[model samples]
Target chain A: MPFHPACHSYEPVTIADRLFLDLRRAILEGELPAGKKISEPELASIYGVSRGSLREAISKLENCNLVTRRPNIGARIVNFSIDQLMEIYQIREAMEGMAARLAAKNMTEAELAHLKSLVARHKDSLLHTERPAKTDYSQDADVDFHFCIIQGSKNQRLLTMLCQDLYDLVRFYRMRLSPAFSSTAMQEHELIVQALERRDGEMAELLMRYHVRASRDRAKQRLESMSPEELGSHH
Target chain B: MPFHPACHSYEPVTIADRLFLDLRRAILEGELPAGKKISEPELASIYGVSRGSLREAISKLENCNLVTRRPNIGARIVNFSIDQLMEIYQIREAMEGMAARLAAKNMTEAELAHLKSLVARHKDSLLHTERPAKTDYSQDADVDFHFCIIQGSKNQRLLTMLCQDLYDLVRFYRMRLSPAFSSTAMQEHELIVQALERRDGEMAELLMRYHVRASRDRAKQRLESMSPEELGSHH
Candidate 1:
């Protein structure tokens, strides 16, 4: 049937969907560790939902690769192998590069101004203290900067696909931003902004690719220092 | 839950899965056009499967975005808006470009040999056939060449994500190839192969991006000449 916008627009939120969203948030925030089994009955009771609703939520999670489901077995949180991580980064590098290129050509004046403000705010935050007690604001600003560029691309399909793949990994990337790294990222963002200002699509794309690769390198270095068990820990 | 290898190494195929695969193939092949509502009871009876099995299959299809499901309503194949089509091509250009670059660095000798053979076969087919007939084989060869590059990238995540997005539209692209266009595509593929052979990653990536943009331009030209209804007919 056609999506009957009326039905989708005002219908009361379903228990299954609510559960799915909550579970997804937990996974993305690293509250649900990798390799942990998620029991349906346990979740159903905790969420005050029926087993059927819980199963539906689990199915959606499985589709997102946030959870794995085996017939006659049970669900567990997903863990990426080294190869999978590498593959994910490779895809991200290309998609983000494209986003930067398009943003260079298509960003509206208002959007470009907003991006500049975001970068300025981040720079101010870095100067305020050697290390802030709360990194959430800075992180949010960082996300906004990237999100603006992706949205400025005016490519909703690419944005949707990349967001789905990258959401759960955002925290991992965020944790790698040390004071020194944050300074470097700020400088990189300035170059990206300059390229966008000049409408230099190729330079913008190259810079964005380099930024992502640099982040990936930092993440890899961090992972290399951790024990296997520590690396497997979600938080 | 991790994927469990089936006991006994093999088991009788389930009717539900068979129906699901058949339906998926039909959708991908454009036999079941986008925006067509799927009747569950009718499909169940036609496929000789239970209604429950049909529902399960529909759920999987919905996840793939091949079909859209509304609560308490039903499912229909998804149709892309013009904006969505443009966005899709933008993502494809980036992904195919990255795949070409990685393929240049990573293609095995055996895979390169296989790609050469495909090109040779298409050339042989061209020598004996008329314009349109020759074009058909040549387009098939183009698809195979791109597929080989994606495979050679050794990035499963990139391949899987791109496969999901491009599976249906590739048919539209294939249908638009003309004999003249095919010859040009062959020459482009030859240049891509030469870049790969020389391990010139930047050249390979640049050529692939240009090739995709050229294809997109052709698609846009064809789309401009056609009415909305005619475009819908292709789906």
Candidate 2:
């Protein structure tokens, strides 16, 4: 139930760290745009940082799998592809399902109460909204819901893998693939929380995996229905 | 099954890439020693590379989670800990379980035959070995067995996450722990392959998870029985 800015726990202590974070946000929010080449000199001048710091930041980005640096072609913002997105969902289904299972056994009493409150808040938000699917509130709430469970799992490596490395791409895709919110997802969240509350790791894992796979299917259906121009403009 | 040197698939393309691979090998093989501070200038001279290339290699090491860098404190090879090794096992249980499930669904007939042959080769090696538990062949065979299934998953991101990122840490632990091979583990591998052969994704995942959990328990028992000096000397 702890929240960190940019959904990352690491604090920026150096110029390169700060630049990495800022650039990370830029890419996540679609400010830099997907599949776009990173112009070293241009970005350096724009951010008012030296090329050394920028390069360091770029390396950090590469670590997050946000940017791909080619041997000769330089770095580019990771292009959006349905296949890549589906692959991510497959990963999330596995990792987050394990996270939920662990959280059922490992989460503290206070953490369970916090998660309950979060789910309640999301439910409340859903009831008050006339257009819940279009609201960014739904997306943020869903992310918060997942993050709380991931943290509750109490596995540092799992936490780092999901939140620090994979979640960035999760956000990137969510931003570009807007309308990720659905009442069905909220209901799925409620069931997962219920399983967690019972301290049922098996049920928790099953429900979490089900939720993620359903979301993947929903997104795939949406993407398949969208025209090329619509898909291109969605970014 | 496709094999790569040093258990890593990436082919080095530049001075820094080659240096990164070399340093990565040193760290995994215990040549650099666990928990040792990385002296930049010393390593630069040792590797006959410039400070810039060495720094780049060190950064790459950080990405692999093989080195830890602190602000102003410099980088150090990641120290081995029982808790961390157990955590890695938990992660492998989830990711590799999913890989087995997907491989059951996705692997081609030829790939399946290759997997069967790999398992047979591992079984043959186990049968002939005087000390199957101590020989590095058992370890390599075990790694090859997992790598083949992981490749068969046909999920590029999953493959990269497991092979490129997590497997480095896995091999690091195996090298430091030594005697990671066991007939018990080979039997588990055989069961997993049988499930894969039948294309029972559900059973494959269940068996793989059981295998990983059993390995974790075996490792924990071994670690707990060792004295602090024994542990230190083992590294």
- Using TM-score as the measure, the top candidate is 2
The positional error of residue A231 in candidate 1, measured at the CA in angstroms, is 2.2
Q: For residues A1-235, what per-residue lDDT tens digits would candidate 2 score against the true structure? A: 1225434547778998889888888888789978889999999999999987898899889989999887656899987688888999999999999999999999999999999998898788778877645544777778889889988998888888887678888788777665657889889998999999899999999999999999999999988887876655433
Task: Give DockQ for candidates 1 onward, in order.
Answer: 0.62, 0.72
TM-score of each: 0.86, 0.94
Clashing pairs in 1: A1-B75, A68-B1, A76-B1
State model 1's lDDT: 0.72
* Counted clashes in each candidate structure: 3, 0
Give per-residue CA lDDT, model 1, range B20-84, as digits (tens). 66787777656787788889889889888888778777776765567877776778887766556
TM-score of 1: 0.86
TM-score of chain B of each: 0.83, 0.91
- The native-contact fractions of the candidates, in order shown, are 0.77, 0.60
Flag regions of model 2 displaced more than 4 Å. A1-11, A133-135, A233-235, B1-10, B133-135, B233-235
